[model samples]
Each structure stands twice: as structure tokens, then as C-alpha cells.
Target: MRLLAFGDSFVLGQGDPDRLGWIGRALAGRPEVTLYNLGVRAETSADIAARWRAEAKPRLVSHEPVRLVFSFGANDCSSDGGAPRLAAAQSLLHARAILSEAARTAPVLMVGPPPMPEPGAAARLEALNEHLKALCGRLQAPFIDVFRPLAADGLWARDAEAGDGGHPGAAGYQRMADLVAAHPAWRSFTGAPET
Candidate 1:
């Protein structure tokens, strides 16, 4: 199986070492699957919408029956300056459009952004996460809610973030990978035994 992970810094594994991004860590030892990281730092859903066909599609379409792991929303929330509700909705629509396009050639698994440590960002992220979950439901795609699990329990927030104060540290990325790898959709996709 071929997995294409596309999104922002989280997908790029920003806080980890060169080879230990969450995508790499998550797929480690899964010899049956090959995973590719197509993440860009500081990218928003709008950016993905604009460049996906030209940039992401080539790599994605090359992999037959591709499995897409889309991790976005954090940058969208960070950059949003308009009304929170409106901005989140707009971002969600953009994400939906990209997923719709990818679904024509691949199976999609939308990974919601990990929770923000900032005091005020959580509410906006909550809205974005809700919209993403709803979109996934409508599209019949798999959804992973990384926010809720990590937000309250201090998993990703347990350690100091990278220079940006947004991206998590190595431990945080590992937590993310573990959380994603344990998701039912991931297990089903890889046919791995449940945790």
C-alpha cells in the first residue's frame, strides 16, 4: 500500500529529527506499506487548495489505490483573522474540495490538527475539527480526531514546542504517531492488530 501524507508542518514532522517525523515513525516496521510525506511548513488549507493539483496530485496519483493522510487546520487557525466561525468554515470547505478531488483516485483519511497549546486557539480549532469531521462523514472518508485526545490530556503539550511554539517536540510527534497508528481506520487500512 502507498500512503501519501499531505498537509502542514505537522505532517512534515517539524519538531522531530530528519527521519523521525510522525509519518515516518507511524509507518515504521510496516514493511507492507510505503509512505511519502508531502507536507509543507506554514501552509494553510487555502494553500493546499491552490497547489494540490499541480503539486500533490502528481505524487498521489502515481501510487495506485493511494491512501491519503491529510493533516491540516493548524495553520488555517493560526492565520485566520476574520470571524472565527467564518474562517473555519471557509477552511473546511477548502479541505473538502481537495479531499473530493483526491477521492476520485484514492482513499482519504483526514487527520484533524493536533490541539494548540495557546489559550485562545482551542475554540477555533474546535470549530475547524468539527467541520472536518462532518465533511469526512459526508464524503464517507475516514476521520481521526487528534485534537480531543491530545488537547485535554497534555500529550502533545507535555513538552516544550519547537522554535515556533506551535510544532511539538520529538515526544509530541511520537504521541501523535502513536495516536494515529492506534486509530481504528489506520488499523483497518494496515490490517494491523488492534492496540
Candidate 2:
């Protein structure tokens, strides 16, 4: 099976102690699976949408049982002096377009943005997640809310507070991996029997 993981630094496993971000960690020990980490640092939904097709098409061609995972919106919620880097509406539009197109080609899963230590960033991320969840519903795509649960998670919150205020450490990513592991959508997409 082939997996395409795309998004920002979080998807890249920024601050991960093992350097295998959550994606790598989750797929570890499964040598039969091939994973491409196309995550870029400081990328937003717009950046991902802009580059997704060109980057994913070649890899997906003739690749049987291909699946895609997108983790983004943190950077979109980021602010440059009181102004969001990307407006919520624009982010939603980008996500809708991206998810709709990707789902047509392959199984798609979306990991919503995580919480940031910046003041009020959590609320913004939550709002973004809600919108994304609704959009995914309409598009018949799977959505994972990494924001809400992580915001309430002490380990995740502490790790984020300690490191860069955005990306978390190994524990945080593991928590994320754990969440994905338990998700029915992930199981169904991978054809892995429920745990």
C-alpha cells in the first residue's frame, strides 16, 4: 500500500524526538507499506492545495490502494501582528477544494490543526476544525479533530508549551498516532481490522 502524507511541519514531525513524526511512527514496522512525507514547514492550507496535485499525481499513478492524509491549518491560524496568516474562510475553501479532489482519486483522511501556545490560538484552531469537520461531512471524507482533544490533553499542551508553541514533542505525536489508530475511518481506509 502507498500513503501520501502532506501538510505543514506538524505533518513533518517537527519537534519529534525520533524525527519520524507521527506518520513515520505510526507506519513504522510495517515495511510493506510505502509512505511519502510531503510535509513542508510553515505551509498553510493554501500552500498545500496549490502544490498537492503536481506533487501527488506522479506518486499515485499506478500505485494500488493509495491513501492520503492531510494535517494542516495550524499555520493558517497563525498571525502576523494581529492578522491571521490565512483567513478562516480562505482556509475552508482551500480544504474543501483539496479534500474533494483528493477523495475522488483515493481514500482521504484529514487531521485537523493542533493547538498553539499563542494567546487565543486555540479558539481559532477550534473554529477552523469545526468548519473542516462540516466540510468533510459534506464531501464524504474522514476528518480527525486533533485540536479539541489535544487542547485538553496535559501532555500535549505541556509539550507544545515547551517546544516552539506549535509543534509538540514525541509524546504529543504519539498521542496523535494513538488517536488515529483508534479511528474507524483510519481502520476502514487501511483495511485493518478494529483493535
Candidate 3:
């Protein structure tokens, strides 16, 4: 099996050890699977959508029975500034459309953006994640909520997050990987026998 991960620095495991990122750590010891990171720093949902066909599709081609993991939204909030909610919604809808198209060729997993540092931004992040979750449900794709688990008590802001308060360090990435691996979707993806 092969996993194609696309997103921003988070997927790249930015501040984490060896830059292994969460994807690298998550698939570790799973020799049966080959994982590829197509992450670009500071990429937004819209940006990912724009480049999906050109950048990500080629990787997906060789990885038959592809599992596309999408980690986005953080950059969108950072870039949107004070944009109106309706505008953001429209942009998200467009991004989802692109993802829908991609899903036709492979299974898709939508990972909600990780938590941010700014206190005021939580609401926006929540809104965006909610939209993403709904879109994933509509597409019959799996959705992973990374925000809530890392939001409270400076979970993503801890030292384990590498002092950036944004990207996660090794421990933080491990936390993320653990949560993701335990998620129902993950079991489905791996086709592991029920526990």
C-alpha cells in the first residue's frame, strides 16, 4: 500500500526531528506501505487545489490503490486576514470541489488543520474544520480532526511543538500520529483485523 500526503509544513514535519514530520513517524515500522510527502510550506487549501492535478497526481499514478491524505487550512487562516465568512466559505467550497474530483481516482482522507497560536483564530479554525468535515462526509471520505485534540492546554504550543507554537516537534508529531493511527478511519485504511 502507498500513502500520498499533501499539505503544508505540518505534513513535512516542520520542526520535528529529521524533519520526519507526522507522516514519516506515523508510517514507521509499517514496511508494507510506502509513504510519500508532497507537502509544501505555507500552502493553503486553495493553493493545494490549484496544484493538485499538476503536482500530486503524478505521485498518485505510481502508487496504485492510492490513499490521499490532505492536511491544509492553516495557511488559509493566516492569509485571509479579515476576509468575510462568506468569502472564505466560497473558497473552501472551491477547494472541496477539487478534492472531490481527485477522489474519483483514489480514496481520500481529509485532515483538519492543526491548532494555531493566536487565541482569536480558534473560531475561524473551527469553522473551517467544520466545513471540511461536512465536505468529507458528503464525499464519503474519511475526516480526521487534528485541531480539537491539540487545541486545549497549549497542546500544540508546548515545548514539544518546537517553541514555534505552530509546527510540532517530535513528541508532538508522535501524539498526532498516535491519535491518527487509532482513529477509525485508520483501521479502515489498513484493513487490520478488529481489535
- What TM-score against the true fold does each predicted structure earn? 0.88, 0.94, 0.87
Better of 2 and 3 by TM-score: 2
Mind giving the per-residue lDDT tens digits that candidate 3 earns over 1-195?
A: 778888888888888867787778767777777788889998777777877777665666653567778888877766345653344576577657867887886787877788776655666777888888888888788888888887764556684445576777887887788778778897687553465
RMSD of 1: 2.6
Which model scores highest in lDDT? 2
Clashing pairs in 2: none
How accurate locally, in lDDT, is each candidate? 0.78, 0.85, 0.75
Which 10 consecutive residues of model 3 have the lowest summed lDDT? 79-88
Candidates, ranked, TM-score: 2, 1, 3
Q: What is the lDDT of candidate 2?
A: 0.85
Query: What stretches of model 3 exceed 4 Å from their correct place?
Result: 61-63, 79-87, 160-162, 192-195
lDDT of 1: 0.78
Q: lDDT of candidate 3 vs native?
A: 0.75
Worst ten in a row by lDDT for model 2: 186-195
